[model samples]
Structures are given as C-alpha cells and as structure tokens.
Target: MTNPCASEIFKELSKGSRNLTDLTGLGGIDIFPGMLDLFEQSGKFDYKIKNGNIDPRLGGKTDIINGVLVITLSNDYLSKATSLSVSRTIIHETIHTYLHKQLSYYTRTDLNTFELLDKYFKTKYPLKQDYQHATMSHFLLGMAVSLYNWHKNFGPTGGTLGFDYYYKLSFAGLIKDGTSELLDEAEELIPPGSSWSDIDKIIQNEATGNYESKGEKCK
Candidate 1:
C-alpha cells in the first residue's frame, strides 16, 4: 500500500472523498503471477508477447477462449513499455478477463444477475469498440505507480514533466479527466481512506448483492 502508484488517480468525476488505494493491493504480488490465483479455482491463465508483425498501431490485447486468459502485447510496446506501463496493461486486461468470467458465471445462475453485472460494467467502462480508451484509464493508473516508483528510486529522469520519454509516448493526451472519472466511479464502491483490502471487500459485497448503488455514472 506504500507504493506511490497506489495513490494515482483512477477516476475523478467529483472533487470530494476518494479511494486511492484500489490498485495498491495489486502492488504486493507481481501482477502476472497474481493472474494465476485469480483463475486457480475457476480455470487456467496464460499469455504471450508477439514481436514480429504486431500492428504498430496496436499496443496490447487480451482474449479468454475455452477458459484460458491470453494476453498479447506488441514487441514494440514491450521494448519501450516501462515496468509500470506493462503492469498497467496486464491489470487492465485482467479486469476485462475477470468481468467476463463473472458475467458468464452469473448468466448461468440467474439472467437478472448477469444483466445487472452487464449494466454495471457498461456504465463504468467504455464499450469494446472503444477498447483503447477503455483500457487507457488503467494505463494511466499504472503510469502513476511507475512514475511514483521512478521518483522513489531514480528521481525525475524526465526532467520537468516528472515522467519520462517512454511514459509520455505511451500515455500522452489519453489522460484528460480520466483519472477523476475512474476514481469518482470507484468511490461509489469504496469509501474514502479505504485500503486495497477494503476495496476488495466491496467487490465481494457486489458479487453477493450486499453492495448498494448510489446510482452514479462516469461523466
């Protein structure tokens, strides 16, 4: 939780209380290995990095086919992506993978539950057609952690901008008001000053119908 990236803004639609520790729980374990446990009881998880012909226009992609979570990242992005950016990409796809699994599970159990989950995510996340922007929120979140770690270890290597060349290249203008929007959305699920553990508890509550909605959506 002490990781500086834990404080990076995920959403900021409102100015009041926010829960900044949502991603900190993820900081403890290597984000990749953590993917295994998420699917341990459910199924298998795997990934690969494609170098040669990845469309230069694309950064990364995630697919869950026949119960396997597969992540594909461009070689160019791999070569240039900072540890934090890489982690961000992994985590972003992880969210998609998790939501997919939960949606499917709920669908089998009760159609209403599946509909609720679908409606919930659609309101929070951009649709698949807007995939880049959809995941851009997570990329910035990861960059916040990376930038924080960079400062902690090496100090502003990028000079005045506080990040650096690679991070700016990957992120740039994709962050306008995104962090606030995400944090504002999360605040409904998490209370101010909550830790990563608290956020997780809320997610569990959500799955069990213990969580209530304040009826807010990202702007």
Candidate 2:
C-alpha cells in the first residue's frame, strides 16, 4: 500500500481537530480550548501542518522554524499506523504546540500556574525531562476525554469500551524518559489499586494493531 499523501494527512488532522472541538466544551478539563485554538485560528496563530521525515518512534512533533510554527508527522510511521493512531498523534502534537505557544504569549496567571506546576514536578521528580511532557501529564484526563470522543466518532471500535481504556491510552508515550513518575501520579485519578500492567498491555496491543482489522484505514 502507498503512503497517504500530505494532503490526505492534512485532511485527517483537520477533521481530528474538529472532532476534539466538538467534544471539548468551554471551561472543560484539558487544554482543549487552547489546543483547538491553534487549528481554529491557524492563520492568526501562524502555524503549518505537514508530513516529513522523522524518527519512526515518534508519531508527530511540533516546533518552530524561522519563527514559524510547524507540526511534522513521521512519513514512514504514517504509512503503517491506523487512522485512529494518527488521530492520537495529532492530538498529542497539538497539545505540544499549544504548550509551546504558551511559553511566548500567556497571561500572568497562566504563566504562574505553569511555573508552579513545573516547579512542583521538578521537585518531585528531579530527573524528569521535557517540561512539556511533564505539563502534559497533568492534563491526561483532558487528553483521555478528547481521545475517547475522537474514537467514538471515528474509531473502528466505535469507542464502546470503558473510559479507562482511553484513559490508559492517554498515557501511551508519557510512561517513559523519567515521566514514569507522573504515571504514578495519574493512578490517583483512577480507582484504588488498579493494575496498570493490564492497561499497559491493552495500550501496547492497540498501538501496534492494524486499523484495517478494526474496519478503519489511513486513506
């Protein structure tokens, strides 16, 4: 099978953002509003989405080049990943973009909150790397909500599984590189004495599973 063209990938990104917007209400949990704003006002925000060569291990990445915001996806990975997985990647990178932008322009109150959280995490997990990922950890529930809604509308599973499934999926890439400590923190948000081992297995399988097998494709 041929890899999806850049246009097709862009279309999927657009649709995914719209799905998140529909699911995330104002003042809701997560950074839904801020993340969605990047797409909703792309011109004003001055960001672009494109497909490019990147590490296969990374689904997507957001960065600034020549003062222009850019979100790049792994062309090689996209050819194999499912549409559902693609949606997850888009959501992940969009949040990164939102956080990146926050660094430059934010209200004092917002900046203070971020600093407080950053300082708290640093103190708690001195080895933690990537402040953005650390910050993203605090918003896992919001990410889970967005992913659950996206799957419900576009996933092959019809998103019929329990909320815990998506909640675990939200922890996909955050459980590594010293961010594991945050996973321990997330456990508090769930039931008492839940087994992350089982949830981790489900997330692992889903990450490598074929979208076509689930009645969806990355076309």
Query: Whose lDDT is greatest here?
Result: 2
Q: What lDDT is reached at residue 101 by model 1?
A: 50
lDDT by residue (1-219, candidate 2, tens digit) is: 134543454454455455654553323344545544444432234467788888776767787899877888878667666665666667677666666566664422256435745674567555333556666666776677776776776566876766666777676666445333334555555545666665556554554555323324465
Worst 10 residues of 2 by lDDT: 35-44
Model 1 CA lDDT for position 140: 42
CA RMSD for every model?
16.0, 5.1
Per-residue lDDT of 73 in model 2: 81
Can you give the TM-score per candidate against the true fold?
A: 0.37, 0.68
The per-residue C-alpha lDDT of model 1 at residue 22 equals: 25
Clash count for each candidate, listed in order shown:
11, 0
Supply the TM-score for candidate 1. Answer: 0.37
Query: After best superposition, candidate 1 residue 41: deviation in angstroms?
Result: 11
